[model samples]
Target: MARMRIQDIAAEAAVSPSTVSKFINGHYDAMSASTRSRIAEIIERTGYRPSSVARNLRLDRSRMIGVILADIRNPYSSAMLGELADRSAAAGYTLTCAISGNNPSKEAEAVMRLAEAGADGLIVNTCGGNDELLADTCDRAPVVLLDRDVPGASIDLVTSDNGCLVAALLQEVMRDGVDACWLLDEHNDASSVRRERTATFERGLRSACARGGCIALARNACAAAAQLTKMSCSSGGSPIGLIAINGLVFERLVEALAVAGIDVPGAARIATIDEYPWNRVLFGGVTTAAQDIAGLAAAALELLIERIERGRGPCGSRRRIEIPGNIIARRSTRTDSGPTTTTPQPLRAHR
Candidate 1:
């Protein structure tokens, strides 16, 4: 029995070593479909998987990446980290993941510890309020900003393009016959400039829809569903629509709705940004603006690897990549059977 190698696989597949390397690294944009298929077949037939020890030795590098999360328990963060790790493994890199539990000080501490341990590169979904420290760390090594973005920091970012997506979501909801809508969120979360900018868009759009104006509303997210249910009742006692600011709020709203025994697409047409595996099946699929998780993960890795292997990037240009979100309509936000635009639209569709 002998060992298999990338060069051997490259030869077997009749492709250049670099091309095989790209395939292995999950960089297939430049590779043709036939070539990709052929490589995939050869790899499958040969049971060829990269050897980490050999890879590290050949590259003469650690081949380890650091991933810092604001809250690992958050579905969004967990999903992204899983995708990032899967992509990293495909590229022969190992990951060291740290969770900050949404604490700024803990985030800073975790990042510092990871850096001190000598990770080849770093990717972070930052907790708010640690700009200067992160900037300093970026000066020393390649850093990729994931999910959350910092203001005035020169780093590559991969996140959803929120402006148009939020507008589109609102349009779809309006078209679905939601007369009124409420933006549900904790409101006190310390969003970076990026998150705040998106929130501003959501607030503005929601305000315009609700009162023909955007006014600051006191946010009590945990109890939003009950309050909105109370406020939305018409002269005939009907339910209005609710939009969760993100998945976190969505969960809270769902719980509130359940405890209150109100039905979705019945009492309220519900939707939110961010996606998770359970979401598609939850309540016959929940309406959401789901971002391309795999694409975001690959793009983040590409930026990190470029910096790690190529030294400094272009003289002065910083990379900001925004992937658009997709509209997912489900039972949660569908038009009720009777009069599409009038009355409470009671949660009749599901129950």
Candidate 2:
């Protein structure tokens, strides 16, 4: 149905535009009960909606928040979205989500579309490569980044403490007495968090063993399995530890290990950066560092709403907040049949 304007609504209801305006703004003191009912029926029948642009122009606010995710298929993104929606609703704001599918151009388009649609603020999980566009967008509406950062852009960021989490995970894995560590990841040029974690893993692995490196992931699960088999055979009979970069990588790695018929924590040890529901049972509880999705969502929404209420500030001044994650140790990374152990880290903030 075509969206009817206030003038059209007024004409159909046989009321003046002023009366319709007052009704929309909830000032019903002057209108009779019959007139109010008639206007409501007209609005419902016509499917009329007040123009957000016009409302924002007049009231200087939209009471709406926009969320742009690089890919909602990621469990992290989906979970965080739910938290953001609930929190925004409680704060009297509506949320609209756009999926970028990890495309930089699509991400830039989403930014423009959300801003033009009159979002009071934006929470973006960027796919990178749009630093300039994001910086320009900050001038029009507040933009708070989630899970990623653009070094060229001075924007607020809320993400997990990847360095500390990776360090802790590595420390635990090294305690298992593995001969080498290998990080399996897809091409992560567009993801800042993945890149940072990869670097941290490499640094920690080399410092501990001097026998590990980052390995590229293959799209085909069977091919990945062959790669793992080759790595295992070349490890000189010493057990090597494998680290999956994220949830997607974790799934593929698990399938590959299964295909290769390699026993967990026996032929090889496995751990991942992101957690999943099956992490506990699938292959006997894969060890993982679970990102604090709830905390990240709350912090991002709080930062964005706080900025919106305080008005836009100087573009040069920015904030970066990192919520710590939990490293859960399980059978995947240990040879013992003991219970799970969780190590909670501390939160950190950077300007």
- lDDT leader: 2
The whole-model C-alpha lDDT of candidate 2 against the native structure comes to 0.85
Q: Which RMSD does model 2 reach against the true structure?
A: 5.8
Worst 10 residues of 1 by lDDT: 342-351
Give the runs in model 1 whose Cα sits over 4 Å from its true position: 1-60, 193-209, 212-225, 234-239, 336-351
For model 2, where is the 10-residue window of minimal lDDT? 342-351
Clashing pairs in 2: none
List candidate 2 segments past 4 Å from native: 1-58, 188-190, 340-351
Q: Scored by CA lDDT, what does every candidate get? A: 0.71, 0.85
- Compute each candidate's TM-score over C-alphas: 0.73, 0.82
**Residue 101, candidate 1: how far off, in angstroms?**
0.8
